[model samples]
Target: MTAAAALIEAARALDALGFMPSKSGNLSVRTGRGYLITPAALPYAETTAADLVEVDLGGAVLAGHRRPSSEWRMHAAIYAARPEAGAVVHTHSPCATALACARQGLPPFHYMIAVGGGGDIRCSGYATFGTEALAEACVAALEGRRAALLANHGAVAIGRTLAGARTLAMEVENLARQYLALRAAGLAPVLLDEAELAAVFEQFDGYGRLG
Candidate 1:
């Protein structure tokens, strides 16, 4: 599919998953010239491919009439910091965003943690949107993982494709939901031990072979 088609497809999928509630999320994919991203303040369910705004790697708009999402600074920072990233997805999924606002990083509570690079996802310190501080914090938190949460904001996921990023975002939220449910049941989460986590990281290349 074309880059534009991919952006719209991702937006719709995230909307269906209830990840993009009421213009609360942003999605973007890398393109040959730069990136095409969702416009700010628009509901994801109503967004068409034509609503996408084109911006260069430096976060300067190259084309399109609409304003880029205010979070484009964070997206641009991720692309700059991690060349492997082909897409970035930010969502305000309930449980995950709640954890973020609580200023807590996810613990290694399940094997699904492996999906985010075999450890707990990190939560960056809070920063104002569209600020350099916010972009820098996001980049720092996402160092070796496919995803991270922004304190008091939402979660961000990056991957080599838009599908992969979207999948990671969904998985992160699912994990958070499970964690919250388990807690509500008065059961302490059985976090994976550091040794086991290290082993998973070491064998991650083999795990990647499954696909």
Candidate 2:
């Protein structure tokens, strides 16, 4: 399917999964000289391909009638920083958001944490949403990683495609849920060592069908 179609599908899927509740999250895809992103404040159930907005990496609107997602700056910054990134998915997934609210970054407690492109998932320092400050913070947090929690905000996942980004978003939430459960049980999860994570990252690089 086309990137636009995939973007819409991702929005619907994440919404159905209760990740973008109340329209609090956003999705975007890199396009010609710019990117197409979901409209601000639009419910995914009611959104269509035509409703997506296009903006240059500099945050200027390039096409479409609707305004881009409030977090467009964050998406734009990511694309500018990571050439391999083709899509970005930001969601207020419950468990992930809860972890972010506590300003907690995910440690490499599970080997699967390597899926996020690093030994751990980082959390950005607190910054108000929709501002360039938040974008800057997110970019720093996402350095050498594909996913991060927005402090007191939500989570951001980047990938080579919308599907990949969506998958990482869900993975982040899943890890968060598991981590939270451990913490609730008064367990400080034992993290995997760096050598193991290095091995996992090498495995991941060659393990995927699409890779």
Candidate 3:
């Protein structure tokens, strides 16, 4: 499917996952010439391909009738910093964002957490929305991971495809939920050792996985 089609599918999928409530999320996919993104303030369930806004790498709107998402600056910054990032997904999923708001990183308590590209998912310090500070914080937080949580805000996931980004978003939230549950049970989560994390990183490289 085309990148535009993939972007629409991602929005619907996030809506189904209850992650895009009240237009609380944004989705974008890189195109041959630029990127296509969901417009600002549109409910994901009701969004259409026509509702997408096309923008250049520098965040200049080139097509569509509506404004791009307020978080477009963050997305553009990510694209500029990470050329391997073909799609970006930002969402306000409850568990993940809750941990973020607590200024906590996703601890490496589960092997699945390695799916985030190595160790724990990083959390960026809080910043006002649509600001350059927010973009810079996100870029720094995502330096070595496929996903990063914005403190007191939401989460962002980057991938080689829109599907991959969506998958990482879901996984981050799932791991956060597990962490919460385990903590409530008075169990100290067992974190992966440095050797184990190194092995996972090496495997990822050997397999040519781009997440």
Candidate 4:
């Protein structure tokens, strides 16, 4: 599928999953000149490929009638910083956003935490949304990681493909939900240590490779 179509498909799926409540999220795919991102203020269920906006790394709109997502700067910053990231998925999924609202990061409570490329998912320091400061904070928190929680905001995940990013975003929510449940039960969940996580990383080297 085309990047724009894939983006819309992911957005709608996330929307149905209630991740993009009240239209509070964005998705993007890197292009030759820059990236194509969801347009601002549009409901995912009603969004179309034609509504996707193409903007350069410098944030110039190359094509599209509508304005780009307000968080486009964040997406642009990520692409400029992480060359390997082909797509970005940002969401306000409840459980994760709840943790973000508390300014909490997800510790390595589950082995799956390693899916983010680290022992834990850091929460970026608080910042006003759609600003460069927010982008910078997110980039810093995502150092050596594929996902992060935006303090008092939401969460973001990046990957080499749109499907990969979308899946990681969902995983973030699932992890957050489980972590919160553990906390609610007054259970101090056992966290995976660096050594254990290292083993996980090694095992994950070709985890899904069939060939």
Candidate 5:
């Protein structure tokens, strides 16, 4: 699929999965020079490929009819910091958002935690959404990871493609549910240690990822 078409489909898929409520998330893909991102405040169900906006690293809107996502700063800063991040997904996914509201980071309680390029998914310090400060906090928290939770906000995931990013976002929400389940059962999570996690990472590297 074309980049614009793929992006639009990804957004709608996330929305169908209930990650987005009242248009509370955004998706973007790197465009060599800048990036193509979802428009701000538009319901994903109502968005079309033509609605996606392209923006520069310097915050200029290069193309599209609707305004770029307010969190374009987060997308631009992440692209600037990690050249390998070809796509980014941000969502107010329910389970993940609940954890983020509590300022909780996802630790290595499960092997899937390593899927995010780290032993844990850090929760960034709270900041108002859409501002440079929020972007700075996100960049800092995601320094060595592919995903993070924005405190009192939601979750973010980056990957080499939009599908991969979307999958990572889904995994984050799944893990969040697992974590909450453990806590609800009055059981403390027994996290995998660094050595074990490193081995898992090696295994992942050796196996070609499907998504």
Candidate 6:
């Protein structure tokens, strides 16, 4: 699929999964000139490829009739900070947002936490939505990690492709759900240590690849 089509597809799919309640999330993909992002205030169900907006890193709208996502700055920041991030997925996914609302980061309570490119997923410091402060905070928390939780807001995931980023976003929600379940059951799950996590990372280096 074309980049714009893939972006809309991912957005609608995530929206259907309740990852973006009331159109509270955004998705973007890097482009030669800048990036293409979901338009603001539009439900994913009604969003079409034509609704996607292209904006440069300097935040100028280059194409499309609609305004880029209010959080476009956040996506730009991630693209600037991580050269390998070809796409970004930001969502107010329930379980993950619940933890972020508590100002809690996802600890390495499960080995799958390595999917985020770290031993744990950090929760960014609280900042007002749609502001550069929130963008800066998100970028800082994402350093050395592929995903991060926005304090009292949501979570963001980056990847080399839109599908990869979307899947990582889903995994973030899954991990959060599992962690919360353990906490709710009054079970303090054992977190993997650094060495153990490193091994998992090595194992993941070739995971899902055909030999």
Cα deviation of 139 in candidate 6 (Å)? 0.5
Which residue pairs collide, candidate 3?
none
Per-residue CA lDDT of candidate 1, range 98-135, in tens? 89999888899886787786478999999987788999
How do the residues 1-211 of candidate 2 rate in per-residue lDDT, one tens digit apiece? 8777888899999999999989989999999788999999999999988998999999899988998999999999999999999999999999999999999899999978888888899999999999999999999999999999999999999999787888889999999999999999998899888888888877877987123
Better of 1 and 5 by lDDT: 5
Model 6 agreement with the true structure over 56-166: per-residue lDDT tens digits: 998999999999999999998999999999999999999999999999999999888988988899999999999999999999999999999999999999999898899
Q: What is the lDDT of candidate 3?
A: 0.87
Q: Model 4: runs farther than 4 Å from truth?
A: 208-211
In terms of lDDT, which candidate is stronger, 2 or 6? 6
Whole-model Cα lDDT of every candidate shown, in order: 0.86, 0.91, 0.87, 0.93, 0.94, 0.93
Superposition TM-score, candidate 1 onto the true structure: 0.93
Kindly list the per-residue Cα lDDT of model 4 for residues 53-162, writing each as its tens digit.
99999999999999999999999999999999999999999999999999999999998988898889999999999999999999999999999999999999999999
TM-score of each: 0.93, 0.96, 0.94, 0.97, 0.97, 0.97
Give all candidate RMSDs, comma-separated.
1.7, 1.4, 1.5, 1.7, 1.2, 1.7
Instruction: Quote model 3's TM-score.
Output: 0.94
- lDDT value for model 1: 0.86
- lDDT (10s digit) by residue, model 3, range 60-98: 889899999998889888898999999999998888888
| Candidate 6 RMSD to the correct structure | 1.7
Off by over 4 Å in 2: 209-211
lDDT (10s digit) by residue, model 5, range 1-211: 9999999999999999999998999999999679999999899888988899999999998999899999999999999999999999999999999999999999999989988888999999999999999999999999999999999999999999998999999999999999999999999999899899988888888784423
